[model samples]
Target: MLKTTVLNTAHRALGARMVDFGGWEMPLHYGSQIEEHHAVRRDCGMFDVSHMCAVEALGPDVKTFLLRLIANDIGKLKTPGKALYSTLLNEAGGVVDDLIVYYLSDTHYRLVINAGSTDKDLAWMAERLCEWRLDVCLIPLRTGPTAVAMIAVQGPHAKARVWEVLPEVRPATEKPGPFFAVEVGPLCIATTGYTGEEGFELTVPAAQAEDIWNALLAAGVKPCGLGARDTLRLEAGMNLYGQDMDESVSPLDAGLAWTVDLASERDFVGKAALLEKGRQRQFLGLKLLTQGVLRAHQKVVTAQGEGDITSGSFSPTLGCSIAFARLPLGVAIGDRVKVEIRGKRLDAEVTRPLFVRHGKALI
Candidate 1:
């Protein structure tokens, strides 16, 4: 059965082109995808991200359990409500999932995970908690009794616009800097977003999703769908879990080296295996010099060797084809490579993995 979010009816009412995304009925677009993408870049736009799960970890062993699970160090999140992005790894050092962990208190933390990863993530965390004999409760809150709903309001004017509808939340939301969260009554307002723009991702009671959604729309926030969300995150150079990486890909080899804190003496699930498996291929960015749509699974022919494109798309902001590729180590910035598309070869230039941030094109 295809799951539906709390705002499914609202999306259909807005004439959204619905699609089955990760076993869920999701909105592809609210009509014009280009306009929606630009709306987020220029103004403010919102995405119904209710399908994403917010798993809560409570009990005395919560912090210790997390330190032994994800690749990033949780100790860095000393400030309450501070969020840390981490890549949960499997035994062979492959990425199980990438999620955000917010340190709520000494014995409490909240993790936001991908919708598709809901089941596996919860199970994996449970197995570890049991094996470690930790006194912690890992509750998956996207479904079951504690289910919640979420929305992401993004862009340069995102904060101001969101505040217009959530005036009561303004005072508390204003204090959190980047990668932080604050509780505003029933809402968990976080200064975090997938799009490389300033925004807040709000988690509220499932029953209250409609009211908040309607309020944001009345506040002039453009309703965006998964289509614009995909392009926006891709242009921002953020990795999509299943597309850009999976259980077979290592975070160190997937352009996420910075998120891994291997320097610490703390022993995580995949630390030993990760340290053993050094960089096999380099993950970098590419800009096409030719006119063509760059898509995933395309072959990249570098001067040193061959590679495959992990994620690619026509960037609405850059007005060109941009992509992330795991190429041979010899390929460096300023180097040119050929990509195979439709059995034809096109030239592209190697650049930094990050394409844009804060609505400005970096490369």
Candidate 2:
């Protein structure tokens, strides 16, 4: 049986089209997906993201352990409630998973990883702790019964709508530093989001999620679904796992090199291999010039070599097809590549990402 979130009934009541997503029954859309996408871009919209797993790491050596475990530098997070985005890697320098870690204190930290990779992430951490002989405790926080539900309110007016609905949350989040969070009552409001727009991700108790969702809706916050979420994230230049990257791919070749901190003297798990085998492949963005849609696993043919589309789709915001491709080293910006879609060669221009932001096209 597939797992369901606490807000499943509420989503169904709102006429959401539910589908199985990574073992969790999630809403693909409510009525028209395009309308929901435009609602977020023009106003505010909320998404039920409670399916994400939140785990806590405890122990006196938590800071030290995380520095050696993740690719990003934990020391960069100097303030309490500050967050860092990083990727966990294996010995071969391949990506194990990409996650967000929050620094709560010196001895306690919070990690929010993908729900589908929960068991594997826990096992990997346990084995690594054993190997390092580290004195630390990793605890997986249960979301179904005891934990809170998470809602992502995104768009240009997203923050304003959240403030209007829950006036108390703003005082704490108004002057929030970037990538930082503030706790208000039973809610944790963070000023970070996947969409390239101003927003807040709120985490409240599961029992209270329905009330909050209703209140937000009454306050003019549109209810969005997973389909809108994908388009927004893709336009924002953010990567999606299993589509843009996997266990076989490394951060170096996934347009995520900036997240990896190699300058630090800290000895991370895959640092050595990354340093030795880096700079071979490259990641680039593609804008389709032909009248066709680009999808994942499509073949990309370049003059220098061949590559594959990591993530591709007809961008709802841009009204054109776009994709992220892992190409050879010789692939550069302004180069024209051929993408095989339906066994026909379609011309596409290689470019940088961030195709859309703040309801405006950047490409």
**Which has the greatest TM-score?**
1
Alpha-carbon shift of residue 26 in model 2 (angstroms): 0.2
| Model 2 accuracy (lDDT, Cα) | 0.88
Model 1 clash count equals 0
Model 2 lowest lDDT segment of ten: 139-148
Residue pairs with clashing backbones, model 1: none
Q: Estimate each model's TM-score.
A: 0.98, 0.97
Candidate 2 lDDT over residue span 1-363, tens digit each:
999988999999999999999999999999988888888888888899988887889998888899999999988888888998999999888888999999889998988899788889999999989988888998775644657788999988998888888998778888886688877777888877887888998888888889999999999988999898888888889999878878888899998899999987889989999999886678888999989988889999999999989888888888899988889998889999999999899999998866888899888
Which 10-residue window of candidate 1 scores lowest in summed lDDT? 138-147
- Tens digits of per-residue lDDT, candidate 1, 1-363, equal 899999999999999999999999999999999999999999999999998989889999898999999899998989888999989999999999999999999899999899899899889998998899999988877666567899999999999998888899888888778999998777899999988999999999998899999999998999999989989998888999998889999888898988899887899988888899877889999999989988999999988999999999999999999999999988999899999999999999998878988889999
* lDDT of the candidates, in the order given: 0.91, 0.88
